[model samples]
Target chain A: MKKFINAVDNVLGESLDGFAAAHADLVTLGAERKFVRRRELNRSKVALISGGGSGHEPLHAGFVGHGMLDAACPGQVFTSPTPDQIVEAAQAVAGDAGVLFIVKNYAGDRMNFEMAAEIAEGRTATIVTDDDVAVEKSTYSIGRRGVAGTLIVEKIVGAAAEKGADLATCVALGERVNARTRSMGVALTSCTVPAAGTPTFALGEDEMEMGVGIHGEPGRRRVKLAQADAIASEMTTAIADDLAAPAGSEALLLVNGFGGTPTIELYLMYNAARRMLEQRGLRIARSLVGSYVTSLDMAGCSLTVSLLDAETTALWDAPVRTAALKW
Target chain B: MKKFINAVDNVLGESLDGFAAAHADLVTLGAERKFVRRRELNRSKVALISGGGSGHEPLHAGFVGHGMLDAACPGQVFTSPTPDQIVEAAQAVAGDAGVLFIVKNYAGDRMNFEMAAEIAEGRTATIVTDDDVAVEKSTYSIGRRGVAGTLIVEKIVGAAAEKGADLATCVALGERVNARTRSMGVALTSCTVPAAGTPTFALGEDEMEMGVGIHGEPGRRRVKLAQADAIASEMTTAIADDLAAPAGSEALLLVNGFGGTPTIELYLMYNAARRMLEQRGLRIARSLVGSYVTSLDMAGCSLTVSLLDAETTALWDAPVRTAALKW
Candidate 1:
């Protein structure tokens, strides 16, 4: 496949420089090569920091701001950010309230962030977000893979910090959001990283993989392209079955575009999902329909549901200010 | 090129269903197709409603929530949502404080929103957001097109409203944010709308276009691909020259990936831009780098700068809660 890039090697470095130049107001690069918090630290509040691969734009970096993360480490394209970078980010942004590290449940991310957290354990409080419901057997593996649900946890935990909630409060809230949230994704095609300059994996035009990882890895199952409504049903149903939440329970639905799917198509899939849920007597109390978390330029989406209580809803409704998402 | 769609006609409706099912906690669609506000409307608070085309995902619908818009109408891909949809959205969301319409500066959007605004003129306070820096003239023939700047205005104004700033305050703040913002875009390759099933425009391997719009329309000028640094220089120079805010002035820089450009490349461009600005002695106080607003699978990105002041910054920092964005 053809790609638009100057050189494969220079793609990542050049891109970071360009991003910093354009967004001088909200972010600054630390000496260790990561975007640090631009907002003034309240000192009384605990700072939240998270980062991983670079392909997930708003995830690691775009989320840096007031009511969210204080800093993000952007690793090379699809790779994990280094421990050194995470260490610098923690030191640069930490305050008296301390810093919370919200690392995703990936092996590389876990290893790196945990190492950094261990190194900075004396300086900041650390927490892991294993919100992905896709994996359940932590007995044999590291843990559940953190996915888009991490954003929900970050926002809730960040808001707790902004509201003068202690580190313990923030950590508890983070775990609560993570516990309530579940996500599963599918990919229609594997996208080529600019530096890689080739498709991550090959798939037929008519075939799509369900339960796909965001980093262009193979999914649990490959299936034929079905009707939009049918595919959405499959994805949402899988999530519902995993949670085993009753049909009548109130829930928050998130239909996230992996990257390349158009908003129009996402909305179409959203409409189908609503019908399927209504048929099952489920009450949708809230919904988020967009590409909040993306998989490079892959052409597919994921479905996430968070069973809600009054407290989680209130936390979700708390205001947050960030680079990628602002209200 | 190959795609995974099962059919074209059912794309929108089905996606909407899937989205509602997935995000059932953050929003819900009224039977009439209105994306209703998830939070309980404070009886005395004014409601904000916005909508236009379907492809701009988080815009109209995703903005609906506590501090942003109360309702959104989703159009077919690249096409304006029908007048009836807008009217319904206005009626469903409007309350004692009235409703404000934040319409982008597109011809079809203006016409449809204008007509819908007329329908609710007597019942609600209608405010139109004509914040596109590209559209300098009020007259249709030479007017600037609205782009990423509209999203900023929406967020700021929405926050002001949520803080109990009256309808007039929201309107005034929205206008101020728009006045302070300017945006320009470039495309390396044309986007492919799923229904069209091919690229909207054919670009050569070494070609790029400047001053491109979001819909994959031909840009003001086509040129050869330059170094990433050179591309950043040209794009920023044009935007800076147009705004003429002077060096050393603090501004909020937004480097938005249209659709396909990865975050790494965006950050590289941002770093280049920062050096360019710093060398010119400009101060960037805050920056937003992501793909918040986008075209349909477009292979390009846009840069937006909103010169900041205490008032704008305060408004920017005000808390907000929405489906797509928070804080």
Candidate 2:
């Protein structure tokens, strides 16, 4: 592999070490758990906890700061964190207002987080996000897989929690955001699992994978790679059709990179995606165009549209301080 | 050739269109020129102007919100912006206190920015960043090429300008930041210029390019790619040697990805980089790890270290809302 890493076994450990050491001011690592919480917790607002596999940088970890997540538990790359990690994180970040868990809709993630919420010694609720409309089913998922729309869930719910909303209110807000959002992704190249030391899948140079999952899971099907505008149209059109928002509806668009894609391509994709959304009558409202969510070293892009009203848009625009997805 | 683009000639224009459309709330695009300015411009404060080629997505444009750049002029992909674009942008963004131009040390960028400053109807000063220490000279550059350290100059000076620092003060601050920083980069694979429709250079699957320039220019040498620790040591050692700061000196570390590298790799690189700097007795006071300065879709990274004093660190931490870098 051409990746810059030490032992494959130590990839997640050392990366977390670096994350803790590098962002010491904004967060503090749990003493004996793979969890991170804000450095300054006031214990007045509802605590927000989110976690998943480790490959998606800046998600659960990078989003832990003021006006965002209260705690995050990171597992091995593409592997779900254990229930123990989630419980410890929830306990650590719990405030007087109780806690809310934001779990992506994956078998491993949903099971582990649900178990944690049941066993945690505090009031807790869960909002599972399954916004990826890539497939009706998957090898390891019951429903559509959660993808980039998790960012919208985090931002909106985190803002609500930060504003001293109660745990029930935060949970409702997260569910609403997740339900209103939809995403579809495409991959130009499959990412290598550092441990496997090879690509998860293969494709010819001129071919591409549409409706790809974040973990290099099989996409809708392989197709001859087309132009940037075409790819953007495919992803955005899928998301728009799934969203099925009325012509006069508005949306918060996120053009996410699958780790290895360039910003130029992301912008190109964003241009086409925006046009598609506008032409379809979804007024392009607030948008975030960057790699907030990524598969490991995968070359591709994803389009996510969160149909929005003033409430969701205000929460998104609310000031957030995080290592990732900031404004 | 694998990039998602329309006609090669439309890369820059359409990408800017996506940027403006994507971030219409944060910035306003020129009606007829390639410039982006803050949507809510304040006329009393000094305005910060910086721009160059368009491929570096988040650089001058992404940083064009409240506490960062006031305006950015985008050239065609990998090509310098013409003097006319710069003159119009400089004149438009200039405030009562005047305007400050931040230019990279590339020959074309310098000449065009200098020409624009001369003709713009405002009091202005320029700070050219030349912190890349990969080689004594480069093909399109004299001395050293400006690389990731330009972010430090822009962040520090932009904060100062937003705080009402005079033109002279902002220039002096920017110069100091530029002087105190050093960077070195490497590429595992060459990037393709959308217009060129081919990789800028070729590398074997096992070979790597060390100390490469941002535009995929040759570095000091190419060698078999090493482990992450070894590569980090190489880059940090080179920058630390160039800085030669006294023992226990503080540093602000910026680990920038050249677009294609994964955030996991960037974090791993950051971990190794922090260890190396700490071993050499340089306390890493502030750190930023992301793809802020990119070279299209190149697969590699650059390490920038700016020896920090209390003043510079304070400026770095000041609250600024930019589409790119925000605390």
Candidate 3:
């Protein structure tokens, strides 16, 4: 539960200032509080924008350059950015070619972004990403909670946008990536939010919760901490079965460490998933192992796989320039 | 520490298989033991090959893609990969262009990679990447420990190579990045290597060690847990003072969480560092806040900074395509 900051209220704004300072070439801050694209208005090219809460480091923001998003609006710690902020980011990054907002499936994100889209009615385009497969237990709950799988959607759609794909094409591509990708997570130790200054949830040392939401929401079930292979089997079975990416079909695997899981655990999970897929006759054409998207400092990891095609693979391999990610 | 894997012994091989599966367009694997470049060997470009222990997830391997390395050899768990494996990776990826070796500053990495380079001497070119700024206790000590700073060197040199900069230019650029970058780390809880199945070191809950090495080596000092802002101040002071980046000069800040620190903590630390730098009249031009490079599930983090010029900034912005890094 330890943290470093002068004041809890100023953390996000201060961090953004530091981010802008470090990535001046790729990003610039708008007085309106959005990260504006550094390249002068590429009116000829469609702009891509994505954003949400701040706990997921490098999710919407680290992806804001070159082959990915044109701009990103970071919210306060684990809180959605205001609709006004998103509207400002959308309008600022948009041009004659229009802008695409890649909103995650989360209710807060969806509602805020939808409101932003309304605010930008005449200014930009919007594309919602609903890639998470973990459904809510209650009918009153919002649809599936978007998790790390949204990243694959962002990358693909971002590439399409970079290639001068029209807003429609970009939106369609985003949808395709979402349909083909699925993610599920498990948490070992609940992380504490600095502002809240307490653990988000209570998790015993020997227990883990499966089907976790990115923002520390309760998962499908809590079970005894099992071996790496068992956990991988559990997460991967859910993903593979959902996508129906049977053996022989190529898939790209991403083992994401929730803020606190070590690379060692991620690798172990990756290995177990690979073995399980091999046994299932699935051929993994590529894999990403690390903290691509994270949930603050929660001690856990997630498995995300995007069933790939020639086009998806090409887009996935396309070059990109971002703060956390580089070839 | 909680981990994800079927078995300790199979972690490396399985993860490599998964990586190859996920990034087939960017990389290919040799029979059982080697990873090769997917880009048709541009005989004019120098092929850079690097590898060492497996725990440093993105280092040697995650960097292998356009604008960085040509191939990365994988070793078992935290142990060094064999010379034979490195030689094969080099031969498989090298063309008439020759190859470069980007080894860490560790004795194991240095000795193993050197032997591999020697083995491939007749057929390929090789260069060592020992960019870590942490110093050994004495010259009598084995070697300077390479840490996160090496990633900066890789990106710089890799971009140079992609731009058709030859071996000499790549080496010069690598060294420049090295000279401009410095990193120091601290650990809160000792990392428990899965293979070791126990904490790497002992520490009370309220204690931390600064100047900690990536591989869980004991640090220069162990002290009581300090506030996040205080920790960031201590780390940034060492890095800023070491580089002597003028108090008001533009600085690139990296608030890196060790394997287990939450994003909340990183953000808090980032806010502290930014304020501290600003108070000292330093201008943060850009900042990266996350776990770019990580140790095992060690509950701590490090701070890295590089004073950048136009060239460094350009390199930082160049597009890269790799498994761990994209865009």
Best by DockQ: 2
What is the TM-score (0 to 1) of candidate 2? 0.96
* Candidate with best lDDT: 2
How do the residues A81-197 of candidate 3 rate in per-residue lDDT, one tens digit apiece?
Answer: 888888787667777788788887777888888888877855466666655656643563567777788788888887778888998888788888888888888888787776887
Question: Lowest summed-lDDT stretch of 10 residues in model 2 chain A?
Answer: A132-141
- Computed on C-alphas against the true complex, the DockQ of each candidate is 0.37, 0.72, 0.40
Interface RMSD of each: 3.9, 1.1, 3.2
What lDDT is reached at residue A259 by model 3? 82
lDDT of 1 by residue, B183-274 (tens): 87888878877788788889898788877877778888888877777777877776777678776788877777776665655666677676
Ranking by TM-score: 2, 3, 1
Candidate 1 per-residue lDDT over residues A145-228, each given as its tens digit = 778887777777877788888887888878777777888887888978876767888998778887787788888788887777
- Residues A215-282, candidate 2: write the lDDT tens digits: 88869889998988888787777888878888899888899998998887788788988888899998
Put down candidate 2 lDDT per residue, B207-312, tens digits, no spaces.
8999897886766787987899999999888888889999999999999999989998898899999999999999998889999899888899999999999888
| Order by lDDT, highest first | 2, 3, 1
Query: What lDDT does candidate 3 reach at residue A194?
Result: 64
TM-score of each: 0.77, 0.96, 0.83
Q: How good is the docking of model 3, as DockQ?
A: 0.40
**Shift in Å, residue A157, candidate 1:** 5.9
For each candidate, the alpha-carbon lDDT, in order, equals: 0.72, 0.86, 0.74
